[model samples]
Structure formats: C-alpha cells, structure tokens
Target: MMEEILYLGNIIFFIFLWRIILQVLLSVIQIFLKKDRSSTGDEYHRLYEESIEWMRQESRKSHRR
Candidate 1:
C-alpha cells in the first residue's frame, strides 16, 4: 500500500511539473504571436460611436412622441 502511495505521489508531481513547463512554453509562444491591437482598437472605437449615435436617435424619438 505504501509503495503504491509513493508511486502515485511521484506521478502527480510529474504531472504538475509538466503542466508548469507547458504553461511557460505557451506563454512564450503567445508573446511572439499576439494579435495587432490597432485593429481591435478601431473596432471598439467604431462600436462606441455607433452606440452613441443610437442613443441620440432614441432620445430624439422619445422627445417627438
């Protein structure tokens, strides 16, 4: 029983170590392949402007009613 427990502990340790290594590798890859910020930024700016225009139209509609 004790031997089995030790073997299980070793297996768990290896799995944990592997996960940490994999995470580090993926983070490094991500640093090199990150998306362009300017395009996303432009999309957000366009959405914001559209939202503001929609709100203004809604306000005008309410005033006319």
Candidate 2:
C-alpha cells in the first residue's frame, strides 16, 4: 500500500510539472504571435465604440414599459 501511494504521488507531481512547462511554452509562443498596437489602435477604438453603443441600445429597449 505504501509503495502504491509513493508511485501515485510521483505521477501526480510529474503531471503538474508538465502542465506548468506547457503553460510557459504557450505563453512564449503567444508573445511571438501578438501584434504591435500602434497601427491597429484606431480600429480597436472604433469597435469598442460600436460595442458600447449596442449595449446602450439594448439597455434602453429593456427599460421600456
């Protein structure tokens, strides 16, 4: 029974370690894929404005009696 418990502990430790390593690797890859913000800032702002306008319209519709 003791041996089984030790083996299970080792397995869990390695699985957790593997998850941490994978997350670090994915974060590094995302950094490479991310875009520079200088060119796209205006487009992002426009989309944000449209989203806020849509939300206001929806709230106004819901508040009507």
Number of backbone collisions per candidate:
0, 0
- Predicted model with the maximum lDDT: 1
The TM-score obtained by model 1 is: 0.50
TM-score of each: 0.50, 0.52
- Please provide, for model 2 over 1-65, each residue's C-alpha lDDT reduced to its tens digit, 9 standing for 90 to 100: 99999999999999999999999999987776565454477789999999999999999999995
Candidate 1 global CA lDDT score: 0.92
lDDT of 2: 0.89
What tens digits encode model 1's per-residue C-alpha lDDT throughout 1-65? Answer: 99999999999999999999999999987776555566677899999999999999999999999
Q: Which segments of candidate 1 are over 4 A away from where they belong?
A: 35-65
Candidate 1, position 18, lDDT:
100
The runs of at least 3 residues in candidate 2 whose Cα sits more than 4 Å from the true structure, single-residue gaps closed, are 35-65
* Cα-based lDDT for every prediction: 0.92, 0.89
Clashing pairs in 1: none
Clashing pairs in 2: none
